[model samples]
Target: MSKVSETTLEIDLRALEHNFRYLKSKLGAETKLLAVVKAFAYGSDMVSVSKKLEGLGVDYFAVAYVKEGVLLRDAGIRTPILVLHPQAVNFDTLIERFLEPSLYSPRILKEFLKVAEAKNQKKYPVHIKFNTGLNRLGFWENDVDWILKHLNGTNAIKIKSIFSHLAASEDENEKDFSLKQIKSFKKSSSELAEKIGYQPIRHMLNTSGILNYTEAQFEMVRSGIGLYGYANDAQIDSELKPVASLKSIISQIHKIEPNESVGYNRAYKSDGYRVIATLPLGHADGIGRHYGGGNTMVLLNGKLVPIIGNVCMDMIMIDVTGADCKEGDEVIIFGGNHSAEDFANSAQTISYEILTAISQRVTRKIKE
Candidate 1:
């Protein structure tokens, strides 16, 4: 193991196991589970996370890019990996890597089918993504017939699954809209399955949908955040052990007399005789400018300290007056009293953004 840096992201693998077990309990014995490991497994060491999931007998893994899936496979992750957004250019590499692709459009489907046939890839798994509600990637209901017709004579690839995304599964306000999307996704999947002469593993629920709409989890569910020890309910953050704890040591501490300013732009003035601790992390490392000027707090000695002005690219200063912390003491940016949602709320964003926004430079430690 490398020496622990002054700043590091600690990932609790046991907490991941607990979250997986909890999620497994929520689904019936018949329900299949596909763990989504896209975005470097949400910026927390994909190889470690995916290996643990594979050992736990997870049914499959899904990544955002074909290259991401290939990395997992190269790392000896034997679980079936679904590449959610396979571009046409990487289709050959995807096939060479034995990675499954989510064909989002008819053009992609036709191109992938041709490649599969050239390689004599018989019964290779492929999923069809429907744009039921997300309006992002996926085929429309009207294009289903066109999709099936385009591949009328191809035995190169098999329809392994059909899935859709829930746009607002976590919000109760959009129940009607959510239900409509669910209904539409089911209808489209069933129609295509009939045309293909076999039932594809029909899945349409993301992490939020899996929590709220149990009935819509057809044959499988793709979950990301829930696997990382977070729930849609922000109030329950305390119960869910956060998998990533970003901690930095107080690189230095300074005693500021009254009327003294701190950081660039002198955003915060010392009101009285006070102590300030500088963290060796900043916006360039994903803390961002929005967290500047007392918008957020960092934890010191298990107590909260408001971050003073202008988060620089390499460091941030925190007011630690009246605290028992000293130079080289550990400070938490999030993952203790401050959860991902808590930070996001302060920054006027969502948990997903914060979780995936961590810079790659921060060393990640996988806790055994």
Candidate 2:
């Protein structure tokens, strides 16, 4: 790979394939895989990532919104996409594009049924999301009967899958809670299936659940961060390669004297003479202001340098003192040897936040 001359997000398709295969190795032969390509494929180019995954034989795709699914469909993605959250207003457009919706509540279910019936559709595929412990979305375990009653007379839609989200699958301390959630999902989904007289595909495992709760993988699994090469666990991280590398070049160098300040509001003061290098990327580029004040470190010519002062909208100043580096030298924000997880850890955040926070304006280059 060549060094980036400007701010760029380099995506490694090989790394993506490797991560996908690694995750698949943990699942059963009959189990299906759903790649979550929402949030611009976690801030990497969504279209490019989805195209690669499609070629790699991903079983399904998931997006958080109907528009995201529409974008994939517009890109000619033929794989079935599950819209994790769908509004009634977009139901017509969603159906037109052949995107499946996750009807998590009675209102959403009724609204979708009305749209489907009005559109003269029969047996349109839809998913039912149950609230096991994630309290964020989905129907309650007891809502199964209500759901059955609503579906009793309608052939406009069919339950393609019954699914739920894991709240703390990555935390070992919450193992008991995750297990209980799994048990509840199983009981609820099973009862619903028996009453409906057909077994809909049952899936509740996300990336972490794929690693921590393999026995409860049900029929399918969803992987987002894992496919981007993060498992939220150190041991699993070693086995997966990160697909995106955020890189930039030093734009300029500054010399600071004792008591002199750097950046806005004099957030960082030099106690002694120091050399600072300004990189052309900041909050506008997705490196938030919280990363300032030496909280985050970047690799400058292979040396870890602390980001000083407040992060500006379009640039950040890093203390590059004593480092054998010059202007135009490549700076690694997070990638390759220095993982995004490590970078996020320095700022007391997670890889998901930093990865998804990346702005779309940054140029994306795919490494085949």
Candidate 3:
């Protein structure tokens, strides 16, 4: 635990290890585990999280951009890193850092191949993404021949792996759709390999796919939100421990009279005498306006206090009339008994949005 007076996003490495082990337990001994460390490892410290995952012998790491991969490489992360959505402009940096890029379209592939050829590169590793069903940033099934034709004579790069995203693997009602996606990915990957002369590693399972569709585990698996302590399922949620806890101190306390408004635009009005505590965190810190006006609550001294005002850029007021808490008491925005999932649900959003939305300015203290 950190000092109650300072706002901090505590990253518990132990809990992170627990989640990693839990996710790994679902895979076979030979299955490669690629930890998704993009968006700052889901808004926790990316370098710190990658350091721990590296120590745990994670097979690979994935990030959305080349800069993120560069950050990891600069920090001496030796684990093989895959750039999920690489841009052509950074191909030089990508090659320079030994970062593998997921070339999803012909334009990207052609552009990168040209760069690799100019650099006199041989057998550069590049992953290919197919649009199984996600219909996002991937080569369509019909584009298989076009891709093969483009790469037929290129010695500059080799297919490192073939993968696709599952659009609805987490929803039970969408199981059929997920299965269809897996089928499509398998067919596409196989056909491409047959045409390209070698079987690159094939993977289509995301975190939920690992749990719900184990048969399609392929040769590798990607654990993104799962590594951050969420599976989007109640059973899995119970077995995993969240790694980050956002906490802040009550900066001030006030007693409000009847009809007294709190925050901008008089969003919340006291019906009678009420006590309010202001926390030094608000929308700027990831506690968005959707969390204000009693839509969400924070844990203070084991009591839940409703947010009672419009969320400001740097402050939020919470009604704490019945609690024995005082100024300087620690308030838990999310984590522990108050899960991030619960808070996100209260805000009518998902855990991914809430976790990734955390502002970088908040001090992240890692706990061993």
Candidate 4:
């Protein structure tokens, strides 16, 4: 493919397919897969990723909001989309777009029922979220009876699925806690099913959950980061391909002398004569301020060079003293052997933040 600009996020669609196939291999033939395309397919390209997955016969797509689902629907994605979190005001739009809402609270459930009834809708598929341990969203286990009571005579909507989140599926230290969450989800789902007269799909696994808690994989599974090629485990990480490669080119080269300060607030001071290369991309492109001033480095011609100055809004300076590279050479911010996980480790963060932090302004080119 041709380069579009100085900086671009090269999204390898083939790697995405590989990751999807790998994840699929872990499941049974009956298990449904819901590819989470929230946050622009975890900061790749939502429309492009969803379109490819749809062609691959993915069972469902998920987004964090109703607008995102609508975007996919408008883009001709015929698969069912689950909005992980839908606001009360967007209930009408959700219904209009045929997007399924994850009802986490009693308020959201009641409000959605009101709107669905007003629209004269019937059997609208809505997922129920139970607060197993995430505590972030979802109805409490004790509130199951209340939910059943409210839905007893309602014809507005029907349950499509019951799900919860794994608080620490990737953390071995919290395996017991994760197991407890699974137990709670199973019990709560069963109780709700008994009251509702039929069981909807039950799923409570994210990517790591799918790997670590395979027994808990219910009727369906949601793959988020795994679909984009991350497992939060070293062995599993090695098996997955890094899909997004953030690359740029050295815009200019500079020679700095002793005791010279660099960038905003003089965050970096040169001790001696040094060579620096400036790249025409910065925090505005998702390299945050925390990644500034020697915290991280970029790959220049396969050599890692320290970022020697505060990350500018539109640029960053790197120390390339001994590196055999010059202006116009390709600079890889993160990709290939220089993995996003390793890059994120330099900033004391996770791969998800680093990958998703990639700004939308960066042109995404699909790579085969």
Best by lDDT: 2
- How accurate locally, in lDDT, is each candidate? 0.86, 0.95, 0.92, 0.90
For candidate 1, report its TM-score.
Answer: 0.96
Residue pairs with backbone atoms closer than 3 Å in model 4 (clashes): none
The C-alpha TM-scores of every prediction are 0.96, 0.99, 0.99, 0.98
Candidate 2 residue lDDT tens string, 1-368: 57999999999999999999999999999999999999999999899999999999999999999999989999999999999999999999999999999999889999999999999999999999999988999999889889988888889999999999999999999999999999999999999999999999998999999999999988899999999999999999999999999999999998889999999999999999999999999999999998999978899887999999999999999999999999999999999889999899998999999999999999999998
Residue 32 lDDT, candidate 2, scale 0-100: 97
Question: Any runs in candidate 4 off by more than 4 Å, and if so which?
Answer: 1-5
Candidate 2 runs further than 4 Å off: none
Which ranking of candidates, highest TM-score first? 2, 3, 4, 1
Clashes of 2: 0
Give the per-residue lDDT of model 3 (tens digit) for 184-212. Answer: 89889989999988889888888998999
Ranking by lDDT: 2, 3, 4, 1
Name the better of 2 and 4 by lDDT. Answer: 2
User: Which runs in model 1 stand beyond 4 Å of their true positions?
Assistant: 1-5, 235-239
